[model samples]
Target: MLLASAMTFSAGAVTPGGEAETIYYNARVMTVNDHFDITDAVAIKAGRIMAVGSHAQLQELAGNDTRQVDLQGKSLLPGFYDGHIHVGTGPRPFGATFNVPTPDQLTEILAREAAKVPAGDWLVGLMNRPHCHMQMPNRWELDAIVPDHPVMLACGVLKLTLNSKAIELAGLSKDTPEPKDGLIVRDEQGEPQGVLTMGARRYATRVIPNPALSDDSARDNLRAQLAKFLPMGVTSVNIAGVRPNELRLIQDVYQRWGDELPRATLQIFLFPGYDDVDTSLAELEGLGFRTGIGNDRLKLGAIKMSMDGAIAVPDFRTLKPYDGKVRFDERGPWENQKGDFNGVTVIPKDSLYRVASRAHELGWQLGIHTIGDGAVVEAVEVLERVLREYPREDHRHHLHHLTIRPPEETLAKIAELDLIVDTQPNYTYYNNAFMLAAVSGNRLERQNPQRSLLERGIRIAYGSDGLPHGPLLGIWAAVNRLGHDGKVYGAEEAISVEEAIRAYTRGPAYLTFDEQERGSIEVGKVADLVVLAEDPLSVDPLRLRDLAVERTIIAGQELFHGSHVEPYHQRPPTP
Candidate 1:
């Protein structure tokens, strides 16, 4: 990063040099341009693509001082874009592997992390896998590894395993009252087990000294997490859920790095709680800047609204109950027990409409998280009402995580409204098997259905809800539509390699209103790109998850080079 800050853009425009200021030839350049074209060579100057054509054609523009890289028959593509990621702040995994930890491995990981922290501190992480519930780690098992640190390893949304310290911290003694929407499991003796489920886990999360609480700590932690994105060819992201604290993180990034920062669009938080709409709107307007603020490296983009809760929305009104055969659990006051356990709208339709309408009227793009089909329908209802009230062109507002089977009519309505979507396609590959069983039985075919989304003329962008943040895994899931068991998942809903590529690149660029500037290898666009060892489309779909990004370049500067030739980084951001 110090190396990055040392350089700055010069006064004059950059032109092609003898070696052609970094001419990449003998390569499969998937332009992902207007026609989804493929070409061999591309010449770039400053940070913009100067030409894209045959090697002989672009060689004419090379200057004596130009640097060159002979791709030697590799593949190059527009840098990947993750449309919906919580790149700013969240509970990051504890292990170095950064994937699902097995039953035995989870304990070992806690041990390793425990060795790093003081005996009294906390160590926490998720079980990353869906079936982690089947291999639940009890208090004794956790105490065996990191006994000193108050440990809480969330095995699933509703399952939590707390060490004695964490339990003590939560004040969960035998006499403690059960959390309204949650349960504290008991042992044979009626003493609290290390498990507190659903709403009960919130008690611990409330008391934990989360790293994200400190601005400097959050910034450093975010960088550690984001460092993984570059080597995977992720150049841009729509960082979801920018609350007041997250705003401070973004501002910190801008203040520290400026153009050297990774490209991102912040989806500012807009909750639908009591007077929350007015409060968020007033805060946003009071800030004196609406959406689409800032330069290329960082910009304010969408306004976020979680229409439904994840699990707590004790809240998510689904078409059916989860884990149970029917909606049999204790219901919250806000819970909608209308049809089984379909999730409930945390923000009622009236509330959502008001917030959305105000956001639209005030010039903010919306990215509402809609989990169940039931939620999607309500989102559509809100969108229809808001658009009718305050219309704008190419609004590009989107619904996030439209999971499970969406009815054809809802998909049609999304297309009719020109609404965009962002989904974690990796769910297909990693979590599909369990999700197929967990969701409403009728909607099995719509776990993600990204292909269906694209076919219906809706722009679908890919995001990783952190099973794995690698875009290659997402691409593999999009193209193969297979679960971890290697079974076809929504076979008919599988997208082509090119379409999947588009979702990771141009599709997201459009969401950020940055398509014209980048997202492709077209001449005159920013040189935000990557080089790969092989063409992603031509490779076995199963091998995609392991595909390597040899070089990652952003704005004509090499940001990440891995097991490849040393890439030049003398140039600064494009003027």
Candidate 2:
């Protein structure tokens, strides 16, 4: 019988010379190394890979106390790295759908929530699936429901619907001048309409105290959230726009859980108009740390900035005007007068360059979110100027989500600059319909041009951006380029399964400067791996997302034994 644990031998047998602590054998080990080689087995010692070769070859390196796991001919690969995600440090908001809620239903829900809380307390709600075309409730409508409590309904991270009380509490009025790069929706009478977009949303959110910032249970909640990644074979994640308090909380979770939780890299975003460039830079430098601080479990990464809104919301800055028609359903078309609108530019050009220059000089990488073609051009121009002036090598400054394909010259400049492209393949799968409505057919055809970008020698990394943060889904979407409608949207953009896997694994490691140490299952690297039921390289591209993870191992220890767990004394981690 296969030994469930490492065999115990005399203390003298466990030597540090060349003995391995564990030998995982009888499996197809896809070592994502420089050569992308395949082996039969692998041996681990002291939380690092010691050897990888045939089962017989590894057996010679195993000590008497070495653990041996017979994989029964499963497929093993390096653990996945999620390039981008938003791990919220606040309590999850009460959720409702943007498409389903009627005025009465929304009012009823608000009334119920308002009654549960104290009169002066804040009541926050979230629209589960927010889109640009959906009709939003006005402040007057919300005031009719929860008059006493300050109500703020979030439509995504960038937009909010606030009641009059919330607006009052936030100190925003009709006369309150609009932020340089934010929008405060107004009525015909020149009064605040209770709708805030972009940086303006921060005003309401700042006043609403999130108990998770100081609550002890936040550690447990964060631990639980990080634990969820193990089941999906995600060993590393880079979270964008993390606040100071949230970073502290993340550290606490890692301290308690140690290697059991996924490794995290954080990016701090400077809110346009909300965060002063000079003051923010001073405060960051005063912290006595730049990017790449903290330990292996948690590290500071880039300073992120959103150049424009989300593409699906179609407020992303664009060179040409939007196609004024929104065809969400087959029933009919929704038309809006989008004449001469080239979308919203969140940061002024001067502010972007000033902040980027200082951050670069301070040894911080810049991660700018540019969804539209115009935004991409603007960001690239600024980066070009910064690099020309500073000329730092290996900066790895990245542009996130090039949803709208930029000009050929701009794309060439990106390649010339050696910048990384952190994009979400799952966006095509989940938001294709909305995207088609948001932009012209010609523009939509080039959405996430993975193959084109790869051809230009651009290192494109795959991320979920919270569109269901699963690497399998991202891989499937990247390989198939299929939408929810069961039709391929951008077939030319489809990549190979191997390419998709590399993007999800090795490509992201480049962002964290862990490419040599992690990302691959090479000898001398950390033994962070996942055992799959089938080989992803050989699986049908369409069924790739259905592949199951049999086990997840980090640092040579099995943290998650997948679905068919034999009931031993200990229970496995749960999602």
Candidate 3:
């Protein structure tokens, strides 16, 4: 088996170096290389780009079996790469709930879902963003809807809102003190308010029996999610924070589906609270998985760690207190005193540093989730210390969601350390109101710091964070720098469409150390590409999200083709 594996690797490395089998012609293809060149056509053979040049130049290599596809004056480009994604988790129950903008919407959604589900069963909802009109619902509201069932709604970052029944089921009460590195929000009456932060929620969730998600079910759901991404021109995603069981499920899908599993890299983060670093590392080694272990279809990339909470929840480690206004109530005073708010860190800085240092020593890349200024500072500090103590070449430690501060010194240090910044630009659109009101306030002008990071030559990448994973929507948010209400914040930090594209592609590839194999449309690279309805460069920046995907090809196989939704046919439709 070892000999066979070696032979296969050797064979794959040796390029076909032969005639082309297919030619895409008469279109603009953005290579996204250093030259930033656009070509008229691209030729492919053996699931690799054979040549990229004029339509006629590449057509010369085509034989009688060659397939020709005319772009009809449309656009073709390297598929977008979402730098950070929670891929193992299944789809959120969006349609089951109401579409309103406030907590009323959640109430309506819960009421509706409760009606459909049998009594005394768990009712789970996801994708609840804080700072929206739909403020995080409390246990009281959930109890009113489904008093018998245990309802758990995950809202922004690692916070979970549980119904009174859920608390009872989990045996959580006023006497149940907050766990280390976790928070349990209480009402003014000192009753458990249903909000469980960080490790506490995970603990409660583990005890409650999950709705039996099988590997087959997970695979099917993943395919559905991938289809949604392909239409939006997303070709690749980095699955951040996957556990061992979820990794097995992903591997099963990849083995059966092969390249059809979507252009992706799976980075399994050992949840610090669940597994020891040594045990997790041993498990990865036993699976024969090292960083950058597979083809473009799937690969083990980095180790992820969620260091802090999100800004919208006001739990993020901030350099200063949240703006002097309540997040849910506008006319109220700030929640904390006027000073530096350390925010919440799921793992202590010292512990996080130790974990990262161990991973670094073992030559594994590190990806840390840092949203608050304090979290960012702590992460950077730890990374710097680790590098100095045990120097390793090409240590690509990433700071995921550098939301609040782009401190010039820290940005420069990141560049110096060669660390990557994984940012979620779409959140700017979905949570812009919350950002402007609760997090930034008058300092909204200095938020994000995209421009500052770029100026310091920091490596940056863009991701949707999966609540909304459309590349065009992310690009629109970056280009516009405005919220839904037309209020623009930090206009100076906004980036061009081209730069945003680079962040989605090359930047992420560089971070994962997969730049050589993917992230661009070039000869010898995997044939993972997205055919677009309109030229991204030529389209109006404001209408970028309007652009649709014509098709998505992964390893020269058409995985998803754009077409109108058709009704499900049962038993041949009575033919």
- Which segments of candidate 2 are over 4 A away from where they belong? 1-16, 93-111, 115-122, 130-150, 163-178, 185-194, 206-215, 272-275, 327-338, 564-575
The top-ranked prediction according to TM-score is 3
Candidate 3 weakest lDDT stretch, 10 residues: 566-575
Order of quality (TM-score): 3, 2, 1
Candidate 3: which stretches are off by over 4 Å?
Answer: 1-18, 89-122, 126-134, 148-150, 273-289, 324-334, 337-341, 441-443, 563-575
List TM-score per model, in order. Answer: 0.81, 0.85, 0.86
Error of 1 at 383 (Å): 0.9
Candidate whose lDDT is highest = 2
Of 2 and 3, the candidate ranking higher by TM-score: 3
lDDT of each: 0.71, 0.76, 0.70
For residue 353, give model 3's deviation from the true position in Å: 1.8
Predicted candidate 1 versus true structure: per-residue lDDT over 322-436, tens digit per residue: 5423232222322222434444455667778877887798888888888777788889878978888888998999998787656789889999999998888887665543353
Error of 2 at 362 (Å): 2.4
lDDT of 1 at 440: 40
| Candidate 1: residue 207 lDDT (0-100) | 77
Which residue segments of model 1 deviate by more than 4 Å?
1-20, 88-100, 105-151, 155-160, 163-201, 210-215, 258-261, 274-278, 311-316, 322-339, 433-437, 440-442, 564-575
> Candidate 3, residue 502: CA error in Å?
1.2
